[model samples]
Target: LGDLAARRFAGGDRAGALAAVEEGLRYGGQAAGHAPEYARWYARGLINQGVWLAWPLSDEVRLPRYPLGPRAGSGPSAMERAAGERALDLTRAAVEVWAALDQRDPVNRRGLAQAKVFLGDRLAELGSAEEAVAWAVDAEGGFRHLLRAAPGAEEAQEAEEALDHIGRQLELRLRFLSFDSLVSLRARGLLPEPLLPQAVVAARIQGVAEPEIAGGLRLDAEQVRTMLEVTPWLAVWRFEVRGPDGLWNVQGHPSHGATEVRNRTAEDIGNELIRGFTASADCPGEGAPWRLLLWWHEEGDPAGARFRAAGGPDTAPEGTADTPS
Candidate 1:
């Protein structure tokens, strides 16, 4: 059943893979109820299910490698948050089962150690940094003990590689604070808004130049420099979301939700924006074009008038001075 699940996952049928593991776990539990030896199968099934739920939240899955901050637009979706919590719970259960099995028979020690490593990674994702490091250290110690007991074994080499991987993950965790931690600090008023501290750390992690950071964020170069220098010294213990505002609410933004727009002509897009404002009674429909034109100028996009008037035969307008008057 586990093999079937793996094949389904590799074939890109994620929903099918998840369903297979869930069914496999149910069957494993039924078998374990009838026989003590089948408990190992149930435990293994738990680990597999937990991994599938957690995989999308892992560093291996996310792009651009910005663990310290939410991306430019939205933070993790609600589904991602739910999956991370479920993964942590399932992995913790698996660790308990593996520990009991190892106590009964030392041959199960390898499984116990590996599960610990996985649990540590989940903890790290959910913003339990210290606990995550502690679990990794404990797993490393277990692997080292196994290597000492079975010198020159194939599993010994695998344990060494696991140790190296754990070390690298720990180093990364130490060097950069997690996204959850930064959000928590902002909630407590320790960090101010409009200049997201997480963005500063992310820029540093990606080796972005200070001047570039300032330009992108529209901040003074010295402010960017100070944030880059001061952020690393702050300590973080846990990840907490205090309110809806803490999450990236991209609901009414142009990029997400029911009213999202894409692949439309500039005139159509501008009309949509004007309709939205007029519907809210913020501006009269007749005055929308000139008001939008003024806003674009204020935002330093003088050529935005082209976007506002771009439905005619020649869609492209000549210069920044071109307005809808």
Candidate 2:
């Protein structure tokens, strides 16, 4: 039952898998305490609980604590800081025990790689990106072997799929580890606008008095209104970006999220910007000459209407990416 629960839980059926763990706890309570077989199952239950909570689930909120900070309480507390530390300890402990078991048991060696990836991931969450990268790489290698050994086998496919997901982990970690963010973006070309930075831009656009376009800027309502007439697709909506720090609506104290936008300038995500113009799309101006606004948004404070130039893209990476997350 314990192994079954772990399997189910790993496969994404949390409620069913969790129920199995509960049963294992009830049925194998004494046996797990005494027998070797039960011991593995018992340890697995704890590990499964940890992994389940870690995996994405609706409303589950994956431990919601940053790696550094004070404890919430002598136990878990009224404050968020103490709770973060407690959660970290539990996550680390579960992953560690699982590592010890698989290392000691050669029979489970095939599954070791995946476990390593999980360990690296949990460790990464705890702010150890180096270890996280190592474990993920190991897991990627394990999946490769599983794929080759089984060729057409379902396990091979599973291993390959798991490898695919780790790519995102690597993406998130790139922010901290020394990496060329612009190179990555340039390689992708037609990028997703580095969502966070794009959000900041949108929020800034939203903050300005739409009417203010009349004076501080060259384009007045008459021109902008007329421009809108030519381009029907020019609907301006304000966007709020969420940063590593938290929800940032453009108007907030400095944060890592703010940095995301600040970096997107030519350095990070590449200076991808609004096209040469935002022409009007309306009647009378139908298919008329396009007007160029040359507007660009970059990261940082006093953050409205400022953008760094990105000389054209570095050239498309030469191939297609699976999809932008």
Candidate 3:
């Protein structure tokens, strides 16, 4: 029934596809209640239904969508949001059943990590950053154990890479969403006028370094301390990303000598930060980077460019001109 639903949806019959999935879910639910031996298959069905509901129908059945929410600036539509929530709930229930029955199974471990990562992403989209971080942390811990236990397994490797990507995104989201970071961007006129008040206050509850807050907002350290005394939510996390490669790491910048603004607002800096990490370059010699290929962080890399390069809209290769096909 699930396979039929997928095919129907791919054929552009969304209503029929949904009806087929409903029938599959009904059978799966009945089996879960009556036949203990078929629980694993039932769980698989639930997970598949959850994924189908959360994603758009495409002709390629094997290709999977990113389990995370949409990009930073936009959000899922109402139906998408509801489907995502349902998927998370169904996945959680399925995982619980798997945990009780298959504690040491590799399939269960991977499934658990994937579900947790998706749950974290959904929570973050719903404005629950702290809860989202907690879910990501749990997923990271599981992936770390899997990596150590099965060094050569593709599942373990994939799980580790997923955690790495999730960690990077969560860091960016935390920094960008923080109140102090948004205010700093606003003060520097980097943020759009409407987004000035949309800072994430999660860091406020955790408290922040006084000097770091001052540096970000271009105020004296004492002034930052004074402000924190009254409105602690104004405390900020120092944002810094520095490297020269296809891969870059983000870290918290300390307050010492941190006042060099590149004459660009924080929005420009943020965009550049994304561009730097996602950009492709020629290799020093004949290696991976030098080949005629594409560079991408992942299917869901927020940088968005999967071909040509990052930093700007894509273009034809240097010697070629773009022409309508």
Candidate 4:
């Protein structure tokens, strides 16, 4: 159903696109109990339905049409807001599914990391930065473990770059209070928007009812906890929207799928994420509004050009360390 809708959307069938997602949102939920595959259908269906293709593959998906809520400078349309809200709900479900899986399984560890990372990015994009940051940090840790198993592989390098970005973001939050010292901010990512506003941080991180950037650093709940634990001074802001090669963009796509994000734990985390989104059709969740966001985080690594030849958007080389030893 979603594939048909995506085909229709790709063919410029707006009505078909809408109808497909509509049915997908519904039936996909219903399938959770009786059919697990429907959950996968929901993820792909969304990409196809929401993704408005341009002439080139690079610009295939239309960013503006996405369901993300309104920004300060912009107000979302009724439908876009609704869709964004729905996407947010479903994406959260997806997170639940993956979270229930075991992470220590040697053979499936890689997939677990990948799923967490993918879900984190989608959550943040869908309007949950705090949640995304938390999960992404964990994903970074998971990916680091995988990289250790095969330090020479291209996938390991890719994971390293991604971990670096996530780490940077984590550090940025850790150093939110120090964002104004000029030199302090410079020490982190490209001097944060000098005037990015403390309000943004206050409003973003959770449990930080009131946020203040003392010495250009946020003394938020999480940071405070870290501070109490003896880990003080924080630095870095790692979020990439650019690329380095055919694989230049430093963001990943949802289609990269379970193994890459799951860190080889696809069967477990993938199944869980599927269940999370699927459950929305009933009880604690209602919308079953399944949603996902996929992108590669290249972190501006110069070696990306060569990596592109072998790992471009259309190509994901099978990792040599994938034998599941």
**Model 2: which residue pairs collide?**
71-82, 72-82, 227-280, 229-282, 230-280, 230-281, 231-280, 231-281, 232-281, 262-299
List model 4 lDDT by residue over 1-325, tens digit each: 6667668867978676678677776776576445334544444444333332211111134222221222212344556555555554554565454444454553346555655665554544443444445566677777778777765567777777877767655543322121233224333433333223322332222112223433334435555333333321111112122233422232233322322221111122333433443343221122112222211221222211101112213333221100000
What local distance difference test score does each model get?
0.56, 0.40, 0.48, 0.39
> What is candidate 2's CA lDDT for residue 103?
49
Question: Model 3: clashing residue pairs?
Answer: 177-200
Model 1 CA deviation exceeding 4 Å by range: 33-37, 59-74, 177-325
lDDT of 3 at 226: 47
> After aligning candidate 1 to the native by TM-score, how far in Å is the CA of 148 from where it should be?
2.0
**Residue 113 shift from truth in candidate 3, angstroms:** 1.6
TM-score, candidate number 4: 0.39
Off by over 4 Å in 2: 1-40, 52-107, 178-325
- List per-candidate RMSD values in Å: 15.6, 16.9, 15.8, 22.5
Model with the higher TM-score, candidate 1 or 2 = 1
**Which sections of candidate 4 miss by over 4 Å?**
12-15, 21-71, 102-129, 149-325
Query: Which parts of model 3 are misplaced by more than 4 Å?
Result: 33-37, 56-81, 175-325
For candidate 4, give the lDDT of residue 207.
Answer: 19
Error of 1 at 259 (Å): 44
lDDT of 4 at 47: 38
Index of the highest-TM-score prediction? 1
